[model samples]
Target: MRTVAGTGVAAVVFAGTLVTGSCQASEATGFGRLHPEADFLGSSVPVSERAGAVGRRTASVSAVAPDGLPGLDVSHYQKTVDWPGVAARGAKFAYMKATESTTYLDPTFATNYAGSANAGLVRGAYHFGLPDQASGAAQAEFFVANGGGWVNDGKTLPPVLDIEYNPYSTADWAGWCYNRTPAEVTAWLTDFVTTVDDRTGRWPVIYTTRGWWNHCTGGDVTVPAHSPLWISPVASDAGGPPGMPAGWSAYTFYQWAKSGTFPGDQDVFAGTAADLAAFAAGPAS
Candidate 1:
């Protein structure tokens, strides 16, 4: 078991792993800690607050779909999920938070990952990135070593890198962009995506919001050409389909709502069920 120094609190162990003690304490008090895969975008800046911003779309939901295949994402926050219930509600796919930074595996990862598969949903894992705390390659390695590895088994989607606004930012700390210059941010992301791709033999999907991507990466940064995009735009504010970040023309998964017909964040695969299955299976051998 890995041990991390815990600020002023005694170390608390979860699922046989000891994480930074302050993280657990902060989470319990509902302050100063980032929850596994919580709706960071919505929490940091509300969708309503961004409605009038440039490039913000105002189209109705109908304009974006016949509605693609439905999905959802979860973490420990939705403790003891009813996966069978979720599938009954028409969720065809799911993503669960697996790891963060170079430590802190989500306590619910193994259960969520296995439960979703048992319920017949195409499931995968995501890593909540903390670029300021560690090297991208190091975090990616930690992620895979925990539960973020992907297999082309038709039941598993590529691992996802859920990089976005810093949930830990506060008044005294650097706000958005995690205190990194745009160049540094992009370089860190490149190292991460490259490392995950090299280790998994499949490009990890990139999850981020348009505003955060532009602001943090300075509208630059060439991501892996094959890395699928998982764009998160608030459904109510998305005029139609959300705009893509630089280097991606289409989104593979769109997280359009923080909550809805299913648990956790609501999502939709951009293609048919067959296409989703093919995506899970990876490139033809």
Candidate 2:
């Protein structure tokens, strides 16, 4: 596959290291603690929503997953995808990257969004959260206007906030966000979430890693109870917490493999396929 680009520098290309529940920070793995820590506590989502088990098997859709419904998160990096081929493989849903910061929109978002749905898969749009670029609310408005809005249709997954590592230029490992305070991060998240929820009837899904969440929001950034958690944790828990972060008690989505054959990042939806369908229906009222 050819590289399509556009995930931004520190946003998707430089994925740092996946942080799970264990919060592993090892020099050997290049896990660096860039976020300042004072004190904060957290878990993930709600206890009842959590799968409460390690899932994800490196196999095809027919193969047993660690648990929950199966899906993928794709961006322009995937080039042109065969949405029908992916759906035929049993992917129940998919998330397409729509925008990053205020100026860059994923070039493949429009095609992927319509294609995935036409192929019979639940589809959602995600924004790569860039705290240093602009206010969260401003970014949210920009994102929504650019296709991040959601209607409670049973087939449309709510919008997602992809908040992870800081801006690190892929060419030289040069980073952007330098002195971002934890409080500032938390405020940014709150603004983004509230703005999105107010515009749409549903809260946006939060995609983050344990380390990024903790560092950016000072451990447990408080969002609406309805906002969902989508955590990315690497092998062996990455020496970080496993199940989730602090503010949440569980997770709604888990991105398990970045190199999985599923196209992009392979994920588990935290429940059965039926339950996942209902989740696609929209958040709890």
Candidate 3:
């Protein structure tokens, strides 16, 4: 997944991200393993306090994309999706992975962006948040500039910040694990949401699993009530509602399955198509 990779170099910061995505002295080219959201999240909850297959499975998830509305999030991993084919197949909306860290941009972003739009699907862009790579605001600014910005357009969904563990964190790759205290991580996310809101005119949705959140924010950071929660709980036996974020009552979107979908990541919405339209239309837009 890490293309355009290299070793040690300094780059310019626009909004805090390296514009060129130059090499990082701190990040060794030959690094460690990077875990997924499942490994980083939901592993701490007790069976009595958790949902789904309990004996140490991931925790509850809160999400958006509208409750019950079938949708998905795509990356280059899905290859070129047939937007028309996808819509025809019954997907109501989609969230495309646009950017990651300050350097890595998904090669499929442009095509997917246009494809989803042409398909009459409510689509939005998402940035894979790399907390250690750059400042949240800078990363957000880069995402918006790269085409993830949101508007009141009824056909488009709000932008999302995909926050989770990097897969390159293994002791072999970058060995990058977030070691910041919960407060620091919380501040970073707050700044990110605020920055994205400043650019898009609405708070961006948050995509993260509860376990990683707890690990990063001490399980107590209060996201703005305006920001929707998108919880990722990957369990075959996932049956109950996802675990709520610190201050949220429900998830707007939930990604329960990592595989099993064609052309993209499978997800669930909590609402109907009408509700989805309303959510993306924004207030007074």
Candidate number achieving the greatest TM-score relative to the actual structure: 1
| Overall lDDT per candidate, in order of appearance | 0.72, 0.65, 0.65
Q: List, residue by residue over 1-285, the lDDT tens digit for candidate 1.
A: 442333111223445546631244234332334544443223443343243333232322333332689998987777889999999988999998877776566667777888999999999998888777779998888887777787877888989998876766652224567899889998999899888888888788888877777777888648837678888774444567776778788889887766678877778899999999989988732
lDDT of 2 by residue, 1-285 (tens): 112344222212233443211232334434344221110111121112123222332322222345777799887777799999998888889998776655455667778888899999888998877677678998898778777888767778999987765533221112322246777778888899989988877789988765556545677646736688987663445333355766788888877655464788777788887887777776544
Q: What TM-score, over all chains together, does every model reach?
A: 0.81, 0.73, 0.75
Candidate 3 lDDT over 67-154, as tens digits, reads 4988888876666688898888888888877766655556566778888989998998887776776788878887777767877778
Output the better candidate (1/3) by TM-score. 1
Q: Give the lDDT of residue 97 in candidate 2.
A: 79
Worst 10 residues of 1 by lDDT: 3-12
lDDT (Cα, 0-100) at 112 in candidate 2: 88
RMSD of each: 6.0, 11.1, 7.1
Distance from true position, residue 133, model 2, in Å? 0.6
Q: Ranking by TM-score, best first?
A: 1, 3, 2
Model 2 error, position 140 (Å): 0.1
